[model samples]
Target: MGDRPERIADVEGVDLAGKRALVTGSTSGIGRETALALGRLGADVMIHGRDESAGEAVVDELAAMGREATFQRADYASVDDVRALAAAVREWTDDLDVLCNNAGGLFREGKLTDLGVEYTFHVNHLSPYLLTAELLPTLADDARIVTTSSGAHRGVDIEFESIRSVDSYSGFRAYQRSKLANVLFSNELARRLDRTDRSITSNSFHPGAIPGSGFARFLPGPLPRLFAALGRLPMATTVAEGAATAVYLAASPQVEAVSGQYFTDCEPETPSAAARDTTTQRRLWEESATLLGIDEPLADVEA
Candidate 1:
């Protein structure tokens, strides 16, 4: 979040003119492309990533497109960094029109973060949960919160007791659980927003097996090479294709009033039966609040 010079302040060319958006993990891959598309639509984009150089490059790209852009560096592995990122966003703009939680990964080993939570869960689910909660006040009245969940969540369910524990952990299983959390978080968020009479739209989507990005590189061992090879084939989607659903959710007029649904390929699709359990969704929401020490009320209390 260091000082960076502004490249341009004009928003005369696109449909999102005068809007402000923040896309996390936007230094490369789907996140970077999403930021670029948003900028092209005339939004002032705020890019977030751990790499300063990559973030700066995205900012410059947006600037060159006649859009105002800035960079905020934060590592999701640390809760403190997420908090700092939220604060930085608040200071930058009073109301954010769009927020894309696109930063997530699969860790090879299960390690605890500074918050004593599993690394994969911490980054993919908990970190975004905390950031969104902290920045709630900064969101515009009709702000859209789009999360990049995965189709891998189909067979998984949230194991609340073992979420923070690394005992008997597998990278693939952990990633699946975290992705499920994303869908549940979005569903629960939509419910809470509904109760509060808020206009904010909260939704999640599957970007579809994106092969050439950091996703492939972080995979363990030969899997990375195999995935990279497959990515070069006709079946794998490119970074731009992967970012399509996210960009659509962020800027599309058709979904302007939509909330709390899982989407793929720009269409609303039903999530797994487990992801649709309201009881579990509520339980996860409360547990997450407890884990993060979020005392502020999220919605009106039920009778």
Candidate 2:
């Protein structure tokens, strides 16, 4: 998850005027680059993070580009903070054209949130689910919803017996579980959207790793710099390059009619065998809804 995946060739001639996009974790690295690109394409962008200073800096960068951009702060690790984010979004606008669940955190040690949930799981997985659910009503017809996932989701499976990882704990393993949850959530979300009146399309992508971001969060000292240098060679792509697929999903015409599938480089790629198991995905989705106290059927909601 520390290296970039293959980049999707950029699409030619696209426009996204009058569109409003909200990208979480957008204050730096790939998220920042993605938001900037979308702004350049004429979308009104909302940048979010826990860091107000960094968020304002990104907003300044976008404004300098002559694009409409604003910053919002919310701690994705806290459910209360997520609720506050939803409230803030409501105050901004009732209609949304796109929502990119790009915010996430990485943890190497065992820590629990105030809610007693695992920190990594709540930040990376639950926060996205809650935010998406909160914003579902605001999405316009044919709107796009993209979630940033990781290639590390390859072999992980949701362990229903221990959703919070109270017993077994490894930073990488927990992250993998959260990512796998994202793909399953995307698929199930598409099904829900299809059953509803709204034509909002939900999809997820493995945005390749950008060297100074999450993966380096716990890298030991100079080791991060060393790996980043090596990654500059044949291994890693720049944040802009890494975010191409996400940008494609957000605005490209290539996937206008495509939804629910896992993507890498703007192409449909088969997910891990575990991810393809519908039964497991459904169970995970149901369990997640229960955990989040979502009683409404996914299909009953208007997109």
TM-score for each of the candidates = 0.93, 0.91
- The 0-to-1 C-alpha lDDT of every candidate, in the order given, reads 0.86, 0.78
In TM-score terms, candidate 2 sits at: 0.91
Question: Residue 35: error of model 1 in Å?
Answer: 0.6
- Among all windows of ten consecutive residues in candidate 2, which has the lowest summed lDDT? 1-10
Residue 168, candidate 2: C-alpha displacement in angstroms: 3.5
Write candidate 2's Cα lDDT for 54-92 as tens digits. Answer: 999988888897777888889987888888888887777
* Candidate 1 lDDT over residue span 1-303, tens digit each: 011001121222338889999999999888998898888788999999998999999999999999989999999988889999999999989989999998998888889988778899889999999999999999999999999999998898888889779999889899999999999989998888877666999999998887877786776779888887877887777777778788888887778899998998788999999999999888888888788777733845421
Best by TM-score: 1
